[model samples]
Target: MIHSINNLLYFRQKNPGIRGSGISVNDPVLLPVLSELENLKTSLENYLSDKVEKLKIEISKGQANFPSILHVSILPRNQKVSNGIYVVMCFDILGRGILVGCAESITNPKGLNTVIRKQRGIKLNIDVDGLRPTTKYNNVFENPREFYFGSIDEKQLLDHISLSLDIALYNLGLAKKDDLTIAEKADTGANDQAFDPQNLADARTKIARQITARRGQKSFRDQLLRAYEYKCAVTGCDVVSTLEACHIMPYKGDQTNHIQNGLLLRSDIHILFDLGFLTINYKNKTVILNKEITSSYYGQFKAKKIFLPKKPSDHPHLDALKFHNEHEFKQG
Candidate 1:
């Protein structure tokens, strides 16, 4: 478990004086910790994605004078946190491996205390160059609170970090409780009812059967369903419940809901498309995935042409696709 940061510790041990003050990832002294940082980033994303539906996990980027520290923050999906000061959980190589802190003063000390007491982890003073002064490292940890992870198991470490994250999110009314019973059942196979793929198929079939009777304004979703023949354009999946009407360009209003601006996609695919992890080429209509997700389950769809509707008029708009690929997908 401690192997994740062994290289980081070794690097810090060799250079006690040189703090690698550069904030960019290109720093020479930061090279040894990149692998571990990326692995930790991926693990955090995967673990938290399972719990939060619309989460935005961000790692700090370039900011001059900030130490070469990995500040992993769990930002709220749609709101400014604490009047624009985001809470952070950082990995401090020279100090404690994991440092929990808020970027600004808390408005609700009672709530913060509640979360801290519930977690019951050892809290220590944050005595490190990266986290000590707010004037120098404004975007890094401020009002730092340390949660010791030394000599702990991996599961406990994740739990502590997750609880620290939850404290921040919870104070801002963004916390979503995980159904531990369901998670435990899934983990131990102690659930009385076993999962059946056919059950999902039956549910989807039920939704598909009701599509015709459903009354609506020939809405974007209804139109996409008709345009794509009730199938996902990328996977050809006919699960009506899982199918979603996706806007190639972010939806602005009624005008942006044109059939040409939309694609019938699976729910997960729709999320990925919106989040910029996936996109399609406007000219070739071939699927494109971000390198980060190339090894995951969605990787198989890479380079595959999306299934098109029979009518040429119903194809995704070239301009909209280009906008998404250029502005959204590539940017991500």
Candidate 2:
């Protein structure tokens, strides 16, 4: 199948504009099956258009699910396949089947080996909520499985693609100018949440992964917001929507969710803290600003004391603060 695609692309490269008996070179992206699926392509495009519109509407109601993903691609050895795209097949939060395919070009063998931590936003981990036994399609495909969107059921696949133009449009106002050529049957093999939650003994492992990955931080953030009265510690910006709960020690495998380890900050302030432009001296309990921050509003907040919770025990951990100051802060 791959070899055939290579041949077709090679012919098109040399003999351009000759959309002879085979698939149109314009519609180079396909499922590696039948060439006569203009009807299917139109249906998929229409489906995507409707879905994006629906998502745009739902955003106002706060019911939108963002389809951010970690995407990776590889250049096959054939050199003829110009565009490589990974087709991610899985289920959504509702346990209903879903698939997503997006194109990313890898020019050479070295590019294939590079792991793209491109989209840092948390993906809806399919193992936890996606492939559960809510519908009749439960046992049909493997749990936490992925394949090309069209491979499962050709008739129904177009309706279920998760990649929406709305996502790119919303964030970047990005639209593909050309018919995006895609490579199929390529997956990044990244299971951010690894759970084969079939055995009784694996309960600990499953719970541990959940706690380390997502659920713990979510709960911790909520606790911090409530504990600190949902105000930014430095500037007293109380806009709930613009607030973010930031960790004193970096969010990683070793971090703890103790309320003492967090601060409720405005989203921009949180970013500044992460990027080392802002920091707090735990012992002196004073906010410090890097020299790069020339704004009067930010300069006024410099050397100011941060608001602490009423309970002394809920104060920021000195060790976490030390780690941040020593490792994260731009002291120069």
Candidate 3:
């Protein structure tokens, strides 16, 4: 079958203009065989296309051109065929001439020895003039598992290819830089002071010593105003004088100054909450106002979600919520 296909390829190359010469080029027996061969080639090409797409994604992530060569050293070579036959086959398949001028240089004239020694491993000097610059190599050897092809480690080759792409992309200004310099500086200073075991122990003991004395450094009003951008969490009112940083847990109860522990509420709601006229359910992160506040006023505020930051990760701390639910939520 291989010989017949080779003959057809040779004939087609020699007589490129003889498509319809009343010959058996379109013979029914040949037609199905050729169709099947074409289908196989198309399938292989499609499979290669997917592989190329994955490589392209990796390249785009790092701004680099794809590697030029994918060396598969274990390609199959026939030991029985003559150097002339091997050269002819290489030329027909790869569209480039294989040099076999030194075929007689081999001591034991095996076909593989002659071809490998004389022909410089089947050169395919592909013309890149008209082709796009983004082309990737995908040529496959049919019987690659038979010869030296099985010796190369596939995983190692892939890793090397990936590393090459990473380096190329880094060089091409594709990788993102870490922008936490200020945070790093603060961490470094903290680390230096904490490095000594005595200092660390002293700091922990000091924190324990002042556990009860530790009050919220920033007022509820100050913290809430800053947290909500100085706007009412419910009404979106920007009057800084009227805005109060209402604590989820009262100042005396929970002394943490974290923004998540507070909300910027209007004066009326702030007064209601400070007097035990309102509470928040921590589980669903919802507000629950006192029943006596009247439906017209409290209904507008009840079941209405708080205006927290856009990021869910930046949402008020669950620990603060847990404290509120455990101690503050007005149970029916």
Q: Highest lDDT: which candidate?
A: 1
Worst 10 residues of 3 by lDDT: 140-149
Clashes of each: 0, 0, 4
Q: Over the full model, what C-alpha lDDT does candidate 3 score relative to the true structure? A: 0.39
Model 3, span 260-325: residue lDDT tens = 776677878777766666665666656777667647667777877767755555456788767766
Candidate 2, which ten residues in sequence have the lowest lDDT sum?
A: 57-66
Against the true structure, candidate 2 reaches a TM-score of 0.40
By lDDT, the candidates rank as 1, 2, 3
Name the 10 consecutive residues with the lowest summed lDDT in model 1. Answer: 110-119
As a whole number from 0 to 100, the lDDT of residue 230 in candidate 2 is 78
- Which candidate number would show the highest TM-score if scored against the true structure? 2
Error of 2 at 56 (Å): 21
Instruction: Pick the winner on TM-score between candidates 2 and 3.
Output: 2
What TM-score number comes out for model 3? Answer: 0.31
The CA lDDT at 222 in model 2 is: 68
> Which segments of candidate 3 are over 4 A away from where they belong?
1-223, 253-255, 294-296, 311-314
